[model samples]
Target: MTNKDKSHLCWTIAFSVGLLFSGRAAQATLPIELEVAMEPGSSLTAPQEWTRILGKMNLSRVRLRSIRSTDQPSVTHVQVGKSTRYRVLAILSHRDELILPKKHFRMQDRRKLQTYFEQLPNETQRNASPRGRFDLTEKQFRRLFTELSQPVSFATEGKISSEVLHQLQKKLTLPVVQTPRSSVLLELSLRGELQGLSTGTALAIVLRQHGLMLQPEITRDNSMQLTLATYDSQGDAWPVGWKPEKSIRLIAPQMFEQLTLEATNITFAEVLSQLKPRLKVPIVLDHWILTQREIVPDQISVKLARRKTFLKGALNRLASQARLATEIRIDELGQPFIWVTQFGKDSPRATQ
Candidate 1:
């Protein structure tokens, strides 16, 4: 062989030998055991302590290839690729107990695994990674390994591996509500009105509000339940003091339902504000809305002239209220006016 070819072959041989030794070392970490103290409803206490132990194990040079969470409460299983045919590490209990079979794992294997997690695509390795930042979590990582010997995926049918579920849970931010019950739990939220009205009435009101006349097809009661936010315990903003502008008749069942629907979905604040448009103190009103509908959409052309008139009018009104002398100047639209002060001796000067 040529000199270059020989050198390349030597380098390949050295790399392969190094990898073999590395795998052997990683395989040495296995068969770990842990004892956990259970808290009612809570998986485990002292999770932070377990994290610290994991940090230390990583420092000791142990390498972990995969990790998985178990159905057993307060338990996580870790796999060391080359440790043994059945090589696994278990973390358990609220007490954060760390145990292992003799000669199962060397600290070096843990260290290598920690390094691997730190370099992952998502920042799942960090304990304090904020929600919504990454697509996965540490809990999911452990569950991923316990299933298939392959990578995580959703296509697999029939009983899904716990790992895939964990990843999906992370991605969707599904609240993990574990009761004393043995099976997994899930919850969904409903968004319209429910508490404010009866089922039939609520449906009718929603239809009316949406500008749709109530029909038999839509007359049926909605199965969805609306969840309301709890008010502050102090009762500073209680609803007792509210003064609604208009009250609609609710004599019939359908009418009762419609009123309730409007009550819950319609904001009192927004409705009140809309009713008193002049309350904005500086609304840009157009004489056109009262006179011409056709030219209303083209408000942009009159905007600057209208704005000048608005300001002048405001100043004139303010001067009259404050009992101050003022002369006003306005542009095209009879709106805002510019305020000018006439001196006893000199020319009148405009006050901008």
Candidate 2:
């Protein structure tokens, strides 16, 4: 007979003998003794059974080893050297021919093994589900796709944001632009097809991947408009192509009041330098127009008597004296800034 068969027979006889003596134990707490004969290539079934029984009692590996050595033959004789009972049982349950490494018996590895065991039933159920089947009909797929507005399913590999925007614009027949030149570029590949999703939903996902978001707005003519812009945690502060309205109602009256300036025979440049910080608002100089006109800011002289006036009135008076025009333009964030240009020139439009 094989060595394993012989070991199994020995273990059976030892366990039978131990059962008879177990009834006459001196104390209930004392462990039962089994006189076992072990050899190389011994049957692993006995160890697996003992592991299950001992595990139920929450015995540590060291305690289990002490019990086996004291009450039975040395486990080393069976050619399974120093393997924990739990590890032995795990290997036997999986029918793995190769022995697990010693490091695999660590607490982290044990928890992973437990997790695998727990997930097995759910995995089996998923495998048997209809959705997991590979035999989906073309008609069924078409019907599934149609149920959700026939979403434009697309997959790209390592494409930049501009290319993606172009593709989205063409597919949806809408204009898309990256407002700020510093917007993030997307460089990723999608593995699986997005099934049964809407066009808006798919677009949102793609934009979110690149740190962007889609904002919807209604125009004065009651038409829907879509814009893709950088996301702000505070709110939708920046929409790519939209401009805020410039109206007196939108500006606080206090912003234009309680401003004082008095400069005689001083350069307009010096007066403006002082007024900018006092107003605490952004001022954009039309350098392109000034360059074209060959106007020197310091050469232009200004004379203003000491008086308190509204910011707008002061700025207009200063501009008229300097032969320049001023316009108030609001940005995407609904914040206003001053734009200075030559007189009788069309104001520059905000870029999308």
Candidate 3:
């Protein structure tokens, strides 16, 4: 049998974290016993790929041990009375894994978005005022475009402030200018919901990828939510032909469900539809791994686990806020595998 086949026999008895080298049939003995201890706080060398494989396996606890090679041991065997247990056996070794270290991680400013939007010329004001009159020059248009480049930030604790709304009003009132080439110039302003450079920029990048020009604004009615209202596009509402510049970006569940797209790509639409299913679901951070454990038909046991972790901003926050626990089982083969399950005090229930 292969090395993996022999390991399964050891696994049936207890957790084995190391390898077991087979000896000649003549050297085999009865009732071998092994002792194990852990090297605390060890980390996994390859976390994501490994963990993804582990999660599908559902087990109660995982055991890990450390050792040198199993071929020969300085301390061979120990005896108690008439019985002797192998004092030097193979051990399982585990690498430590990372988790969310704290409560929350957020970026972008909602109050700022509110202020930006409040300043914009609303439909009512525009209706009351005359159109097609201009005092703004090309330099002023460039200034407005430059203003669009500021990143958005979000709040973690409370609602956005009214002061942010006032600021938006001021920024939105800049003079609308007509270009020398006669291409219509409408000042576009967007108020951001989430805060932080990555989140804000991701959203902005996505909007830009979609071919729509946006400026930031802030409002307070919604907390932990994304609200997109086309405040102004030129002198009109959001126009056609504009597409978001970035796709495949990260979003919190709150916003994930709220956001919508007008795209025709079937695969992309499928992904969005999955994100917005009516059922309230766990926000599977982009790098979520699923794993499973089972007995194979062959006597040679195989235990497999999958792992996935991403370095995106939202994931960084999740890692900062999470703690991971893993359970594992060994089979006839010396292969060590994990059963990965996640638990949280505030964890959302799994959805259908």
Model number with the top lDDT: 2
* Pairs that clash in candidate 2: none
Please identify which of the two predictions, 1 or 2, would achieve the higher TM-score against the true structure: 2
Per-residue CA lDDT of model 1 for 212-308, tens digit only, reads 2212110012111111112222311111111222231211112122111111232322322342333222122222111222222222111111222
lDDT of 2 at 203: 51
- Of 2 and 3, which scores higher on TM-score? 2
The stretch of ten residues in a row with the least summed lDDT in candidate 2 is 58-67
lDDT of 2 at 57: 28
Regions of candidate 3 where Cα sits further than 4 Å from its true position: 1-137, 154-161, 167-192, 197-352
Off by over 4 Å in 1: 1-3, 22-352
TM-scores of the models, in the given order? 0.15, 0.31, 0.18
Q: After superposition, how far is residue 59 of candidate 1 from its true place, in Å?
A: 11
